[model samples]
Target: MPKVRIVDIEDRRFRVFSSPTVPGGREFVLVHGIGISHRLFSRLHRVLSAKHTVHTLDLPGFGGMPRPDSDPDIADMARDLAEVLERLGIGPVVAVGDSMGTQWVVELGAQRPDLVTHVVAIGPVADARHRTLFAQAAALGLDSLREPPSANARVLVEYARCGPRWYGRQVRHMIDYPLEQRAAELVPPLLVMRGGRDPIAGPEWSRAVARCAPRSRFVEVPGQPHLVQHTAPRPVAEAIEWFLAEVPQ
Candidate 1:
């Protein structure tokens, strides 16, 4: 089991689940999307931990972490993430995020280039074409239908923990974040990935997100849904490995 630790940042708190380090192995950080927690990345954490150190984060206001007095935008969450990494003394890591988590990691890479060596966006969100709250909600609804039972159950449980009030507060930030613009500004190599069948981060949007980055590659995992990382951990892990191999470490 990964060691779980609580890191407090002012009025907010974060939960970090860390796997034992492997000597000479590269570090990897996993960030979950909106209304979810580190539990969503459990499978991916298991796979990555086999070869490298893995840290899964439950940012403030989600994953049973204490919610701040007020809502934070994407950049605020990114700063909190950076602080956790700095406090943990882990840096220059391959930062991987799913859905809105992509925005957080992208902002992290843009704000603290020294902390992240690479940014992997799995099923990135806020498709340039459908940036409205209703459009994103529809996509998420459709994705729920496509996800496997286990994945849906996990998401439901996490959502219940997050509560509708908090989820509502965060969705606005997720919808408003300009991920493509941030990706273009990121100094680290970017890997944009999506499930071939994902409705939220469709093929064109994923490609566009990748194209925004000077150094980026796009990969599609076939027959998977939005939460591809959770449902198809091995394939996602393989795709990340391929990206890492191609990227100049």
Candidate 2:
């Protein structure tokens, strides 16, 4: 079982699930997408933890965690994530994020290069061509059709726990975030990945994101949907390993 803890950063609270560290293995931090929690990364965590230390976060206002009194934009959330990593004494890690979580990790890498060694974006969101709420929602709906029932069920349960009010508050930030711009500014190497069938993160956009980074690569998991990590953990893990090995550390 992973060690679970509640971490408070000023007014915001976060829930973290961490696995034991493997000797000689690098550390990894996983951040979930909007309206979801660390639970979505459970399968990926299990696979990655077999060789590396994995820490999954349930950001404030998601995963049944208490929300902050005021709304936090993308930058604020990134700063909070930095603080959490600092407090935990885990830094220079391979930070992985899904969907809107990719925005957060990009911002974190841009703002605090010392804390992140490499950044992995899985099914990154808010495509520049389709940044509107309607566009994103429509894309999400289409991706749902591609996802397995198990992936959809976990997303639905997490969304319920996140609640519409908080989700609505954060979606605005997500849509407004300049993920590609931030990724371009990152000092750490970047890996932009997407499910081959993901409607949200299209091939063109994923390639564009990879192009933004000075040091980056793009990988596509064949026939998977938006929540590919959940449905195809082994493939995702293998891609990550490949990226890390190929990229100059």
Candidate 3:
């Protein structure tokens, strides 16, 4: 496992990632969800590292990366990610985002339509109203959503690195971000997939995202949870590989 590398892209500190992905392979950037860092996709990263140069980022305030106290919202994070990509000279690259990262995918694809060519989203929250759906998770008494494989141990540490106060603030921002209407506007060649047993995002939600974007396709994986990439990296990576290969030219 390669330790994450940090780079001062412009003024923001970015934890940049790059995998060999074969001698002469293409590159794709992986973006993680809230409270989770690049480590969320560790299993998938290792799997795909052989075929595609994989890149992940430790967005500000969420993975030991300095976050702006004032810009403590998804919009700000999106802008930061865009700058990170531009500064690193890594645009027009395939982007695979999960959950919160999916929100950034919408932001980046909409704002910088020319920058990101393809997007693969797993367990994505299509609309902000869906945020309320998470509260019900606690009600269901499901521990799976709270705990994942040890690979995500780093995510817990990264969230802790940001502290509870900041973490709560970010959650509040996400719950209040008014996402659905705007996300519907910027579809971009998207692949929205959900876990079959995912309490956070079920089939209806995935369908809504697919409907929101005519170009987007919705896939449902049976017997998986919120951590689709972690619980089943093979399927997630396979879906991503297929999407990348089938991307519209």
lDDT of 1 at 72: 81
lDDT of each: 0.92, 0.92, 0.70
Which sections of candidate 2 miss by over 4 Å? none
Candidate 2 Cα lDDT to native: 0.92
Q: Candidates 1 and 3: which is better by lDDT?
A: 1
A best-first ranking of the candidates according to their lDDT comes to: 2, 1, 3
Q: Encode model 2's per-residue lDDT on 45-152: one tens digit a residue.
A: 999999999999999999989978889899999999999998888867899999999999999999999999999999887887669988989999998999888888
List CA RMSD, all candidates.
Answer: 0.9, 0.8, 2.9
Screening candidate 3 with a backbone cut-off below 3 angstroms (N, C-alpha, C), the clashing residue pairs are none
TM-scores, one per candidate: 0.98, 0.98, 0.85
Q: Quick one: how many clashes does candidate 2 have?
A: 0
